[model samples]
Target chain A: MNYPNGQKKIISKQATSWQSKKSFSNRGMSLEDDINTTNQFYLDIDRAVIHKKPTPVQIVNVHYPRRSAAVITEAYFKQASTTDYNGLYRGKYVDFEAKETKNKTIFPLANIHEHQINHMKSIVEHEGICFLLIRFAAHEETYYMQAEKLFPYWYDKLHGGRKSIPYEKIKLDGFHIPLQYQARVDYLSVIDKLYF
Target chain B: MNYPNGQKKIISKQATSWQSKKSFSNRGMSLEDDINTTNQFYLDIDRAVIHKKPTPVQIVNVHYPRRSAAVITEAYFKQASTTDYNGLYRGKYVDFEAKETKNKTIFPLANIHEHQINHMKSIVEHEGICFLLIRFAAHEETYYMQAEKLFPYWYDKLHGGRKSIPYEKIKLDGFHIPLQYQARVDYLSVIDKLYF
Candidate 1:
């Protein structure tokens, strides 16, 4: 396959075959759910250990529903200081953020926060595997773009370039994550190829 | 000073004098407030960057109060899979659970869940620093007890022993966290002495 920018796309035939067999029928699985299922599979198989960080919530008002249960009556989402997924993999810390975009031609840099980029930089400096898992829903493709490729483009965007990472650039620079039967978002396969 | 068990208490006279002069005020502070202040101090001073995991809430109902804000009308506290605080310290992963006890003579083991203990064990197996910050609220004394010491006692409790860890045992096995001007918990000081 080729993009508009004339970049050759390395589409995995095996991944396409797996996607065809899978229906993802659990209340319409979101990207988060798929990643979580993948992480669980990794844990069960004793592969790379990974987990999604619990959603940060600030409790303002809580009511005692029963002796054992406390019902939160008021709360708000709090900004997370670190990326969603971070854990040790083969004696090295692996950290990454997962985001999905509906845009066919571009992946919006705005989907990622400044702090997340900084966090990824620190992880990279500390000799950890750091990257972003970008999913283009329109194309039904997921790419694992390393922090080195992301930071320069992110800075360029800050200096008034395009606000999105071109699909062609992602296709060229990123590793496509294979969707699996057990590990729904099987990102570790990409990590194993790229890092190890 | 000597306990009924005939163990000589290691009371630092200098520390006592320092505490008297400082007048450590536990009256005005809630457990949450003290922890937040301590975390801020940790971050500012570059001492063991630790943060409390945010309270997990499952939002079920929401009301649009205004165009700008959505108010959560109903939610419930989700069961936490891991302990409260975790972070990196001096290239070592640090994970711990903090609890406060009103009892003067005993710290209840029942306060800790089995899953939390298991999580701490896994952290220890991975060469991470895993411990518990236990505060005896009645005496205004806080101690950092290593998970290794905690496990045996927890098992003994399961076999019908006293449900609480005796204050004397805590004093012997755990490091007494000194109250400091900048860092309220001053746990890293104890960690340095015990681990590093």
Candidate 2:
């Protein structure tokens, strides 16, 4: 993922500036869109079968029109009980949640839900590969933090400790997912290095 | 998972008959409900991490109130590109589409979609465990048909062959999933015999 020294600095500066201009949180239309494009590329090349689960909705009412599709007249979003993305990768169960933070210092622990942590715990216990993809928008970096690493932090938060993982801590412990041409969020490469 | 062994008619037969009368045209509300409950049982006991993906919906309009959660005003169901349920089981990626057929002699191919077949093809190619959970409500029998077994029928249909799988053929080729108190479908035992 090496770029010309000048080009790398220029790109970093532009992304750093995006922290303020992009008021929209990554809950998640930006990083998610890139990951989806990356997943499609992986699928086209016969690499993996990862997909973001559809947004869960509670349908309250439906209007069935004659000679037309049933329209949902009233519905509400349901909080997910599991991670946002999961699938098979290289004959292994891959599960992960992805989030982007504009914060330059730390990633707030509140970005993740308690149930999601429990879900990750179960995946890890079952010997499946589980992790988090944390994107620091200020630095334009995405880190792959293993479920094992995340548990301690979540436990610490529950124990009324620091409510965030410092950027430096993540930079030291997490693998930097390289930005690529087709696989924009090239995570499998990191999985290969760590697991394979 | 063995029951009293005398016809094994413990599960509410009256409800099954009622469900067939109001069958959702093979969209599988009856079987889907049972499978969802079964999956929860699996998760509770730490046997598997299977989940039914949320029904895909196209949100057309949403109203954001100042002091409450956003409500979807208009939406429509979208066709799923993949199967309904998938997750990790026995360290293997498990994927399947569950459907119930009231037909006594044949399971219709129309119950599945073209994209789902392609998605199954991909899963099989990647060495993931993929299959179909076909339940015959009339006979109260459920069969676990492997993805490999399903491909030939799909191709045959494309080549102007039979548009449905015969009940007898399924009985011969597919494994019978045992009815259980917890794992209602109990397909993993069949998986143990085949893939494990």
Candidate 3:
């Protein structure tokens, strides 16, 4: 009973049962799906309480015809001011943004917004665990780079440095997230080693 | 200048500056507005980073006309599975649901959803600070009640007990959130006292 729409199915109870599978070894799902599955797994075992924020939408007009639910007739997509996923881990505040890039050589800085960068900086200043989850879809590899580490490259772009992070550089700096049967992207194990 | 529409003014950046008025003593605003203003004040002083989750919407049809932004032609409101607000404070994970009631005698349990109650329970089990911010709109008083304290009443309702919490009980058990000039609701002060 897999739905074609990822967002719809993820919100449904069926998705929770779907994740009960022993493995997703070669399913080739999107990075969002994998992370959502991992989050659901974390929630089920009382390990963490993280969630992906809903897509921001700007509503202009809504029509109330009859007694049914009011329908949004005119609306536009709005940019999110913060990251996609946030939650609690080990009684510590964790905040992160996840992005998937098709490029094989580099991950572009344009994938993240300026406001979001500022938001992450503020979180780190407040002693929160902030990071960026970068997924190279071409290579099927993901890395978790701390916001502190990424700040250097982000500031370099303003000073006429490269606009993207090279794959080799990420391999050197960022921690690789291993995929597993229960915890799809076991990034927390890395956090436990680094931050804790 | 107060706008006629609530949504328009809320999503605007100018609203943050509007809170420069030393106090919200006379200006009657909803609990949500007060909390947002308080959060902005916290952020300005590097105190905390808390935000209310946006209202969820389910998009049915979207149209891309010309080079402008993508317009959602049809959409419907969706019920949120978790609480309204969540974030980090003092390197600790904090999660809470805020609700306002006009009732003067008791706070009805029906104001909260079963899933939200369960969600908060799970958050507490994970060793996260979880609570409810209940505002008595008539009296203009707010109280912060720990989720652990509320669990007994929540379970009692299932056993044919009282469906509402008496005002006297809340006054005895819950901590009063003093209204302040800079921080409107000043719930964080209560959090500081209890959790810290």
Candidate 4:
């Protein structure tokens, strides 16, 4: 797979920094991978049950080879209706989207979809615990910000506000998630402090 | 779509009666579809926010044809790691599996997967609301039975007990969900009565 020139440069720089953090060498792994590993860790220890929703697909056709499993021959990816990760966490429905940005000053709102913002709003309205696990990759920092806190910036764009959230503001509003050996992105600890 | 002779006969009879229940005309629709529609009704009114997890698929290959959307050329169905439907209902986590049985006298244990039972067990362990929305298609009845109640029956089969739960026993232990105009399988009312 090939990334655009600018993104490719960022990837190379990320790979370089990944080497320095040799203990956590897997830092080069995508934020999604880290969270998946963390969720698996949670499940293993019976802390919380969470999972990433499968990529939605619109299957147009399938072929059942004589004795093998049916193969999807014609299909297209479908737009997801909700955020990827969601499950039960201490009796509360936990819903969130994980995203990362390379920008030093801001996290572009463009990385998030309007429907996803709306979905997060609905989850909040239903009294679920919703948030965004955003990683400022350049700073090697991940923060857990509640969905309610994000709505202002999302709606601000409609009211002629900045298109991206200033990293300084996020640092003030979001809780820094600590990284650990087994629990890669230990966001649940932040959840315990914030909600529980 | 083809079923064995005896099962096919049951399906034909089902199709015939499905047309007569014109009010619940969507009787031909799968149990999953009915619950999805019911969940939509709840969402539309801001009563709850729930969604069905997309069918999991293993994408082996994709073709990026020019500027058009990428076409999935090779993929196969994957077993889901969690329940079909889950979300927040009045500040609590609600998770459940929907399954239909053609048998008139009993609901077979084969309809429930071992992993799903374990998943439900974990949800209950975390104090979340978990249950099975079982539909007896032959009798045209649906029941909402809590997962904790199901554990004994599930374990009973593993310990050389009955392979199926009799319909009479279910009627005794499970709450019957009545069908309504817009909310076809209004299981939330049962949840309210039982959980709230």
Tell me the tens digit of each residue's lDDT in model 2 across A1-196: 1211112222233323322234444333367777888899989999999998988876666776776666676666777889989988888999999988889999999999898999999899888999999988878788999989989988999998999999999999899986667888999898898889
> Could you estimate the TM-score for every candidate?
0.78, 0.86, 0.86, 0.86
Alpha-carbon RMSD, each predicted model: 14.0, 10.5, 6.6, 9.4
A1-196: candidate 1 lDDT, tens digit per residue = 1121233334344423322223333335556767888877776665655667766754556665344455556555556777887665554466789887778999999898887887677666655678899877777778889999999999999999878899999999998876667887877777778767
lDDT (Cα, tens digit) per residue for candidate 2, span B11-67: 243323522344643434467777887999999988999999987866667766666
lDDT of 1 by residue, B7-99 (tens): 333324442332122333446554445667887887665554456776555555655545434445566655666787766566556678888
Query: What is the lDDT ranking, best to worst?
Result: 2, 4, 3, 1
TM-score of chain A of 3: 0.85
* Residue B183 miss distance in model 1 (angstroms): 2.5
What's the true lDDT of residue B53 in model 2? 92
Indicate the residue-level lDDT of B36 in model 2. Answer: 82
C-alpha lDDT (0 to 100) for residue B6 of candidate 1: 33
Error of 3 at B78 (Å): 1.3
Q: How close is candidate 1 to the true structure, as a TM-score?
A: 0.78
The candidate that achieves the highest DockQ relative to the unseen native structure: 3
For model 1, what is the alpha-carbon lDDT of residue B90? 63
- Model 1, position B84, has a per-residue lDDT of 77
Candidate 4 per-residue C-alpha lDDT over B39-92 given as tens digits, one digit per residue, 9 for 90 to 100: 899989988988888878667677766756666776676667788889899999
